[model samples]
Target: MDAFSNVDSNNRGKRIIDGYTPEPYHMPWIGLLVKDGKARCTAFLVSKNANAKASVWVLSAKHCFNDVLFDEYEDKTINSTSYGLLFGVHDLRFSTQHVIYRTIDELFIYPDEGLKTKDIILIKLDRQIKFNSYINGLCLPDSTEEHTPYEDTPW
Candidate 1:
């Protein structure tokens, strides 16, 4: 058993009930998806660009783009230029030298009507990311875990 052994069981794959802000770089894969300079949703780096040293692909929630709060964009085609990802920063309110913002080059969403249980979207950055201590990709799940039950899995 470790310090988080109890937390791990209680949380059941979710963050702490009342979580405190994590230190910078503690969760390097985390990202902030934004549109026109405002926050849209939270995202995470899933893989690195094949030809680049850092990650360029991120995963986010599909509802971020479909929510009634963002209805202004539902009728208009989503312009990649208007969206971006902010990586390597913990606090957006403060200016940070470690932050890196990348414009979105493309968005891949599974066309699910009514946006049911399939709530994921993949975003490609316009340029290759440069990895630092504060930015990196999360390890991808292996094929063996494909059939594992969600409740028993660790993200």
Candidate 2:
């Protein structure tokens, strides 16, 4: 039973995530950080830069590369150039034909940043990512949806 019971599914209302994977290539902008050919963390393609052009900018949680297990590099530092991201893939255990791995040329994070607080970082791919049906950049939200009207988010 939903408030929009009267409303049909055709009328998309503030869509909610139900752990449902969208149609393949529907979210081709998403990528997984690959460590030794294994997926570790998640990353998403954003911005169109001249260097890498189509989705050159990769945004990910800074804590993903943290040295300490329990702490966010409170005692150590994060190896920015250690890991690489694998795009055009849905699963790591099984390799797909479109899986493309790109090394991390560099990573950017605040000097005094902490994991408990803001734990996000941006990475630059060693090479440009070719945009395809299963690999592309996502459009950064403009000023249209400023604030999420709902409170509970499962992202």
C-alpha lDDT values of all predictions: 0.65, 0.61
Models 1 onward score TM values of 0.70, 0.66
Residue 34 CA error for candidate 2 (Å)?
2.1
Candidate 2 runs further than 4 Å off:
1-18, 49-53, 68-82, 143-145, 149-155
Which residue pairs clash within candidate 2?
none
**Residue-pair clashes per candidate, as listed?**
0, 0
Shift in Å, residue 44, candidate 2: 0.5
Q: How well is each residue in 1-155 modelled by candidate 1, as lDDT tens digits?
A: 12111111221234545545665678787887766566667788876333345777888888887743334544333676556777876765554677777777767776666678899888788887777778888766776766655321112
Error of 2 at 130 (Å): 1.7
Clashes of 1: 0
Highest lDDT against the true fold, candidate = 1
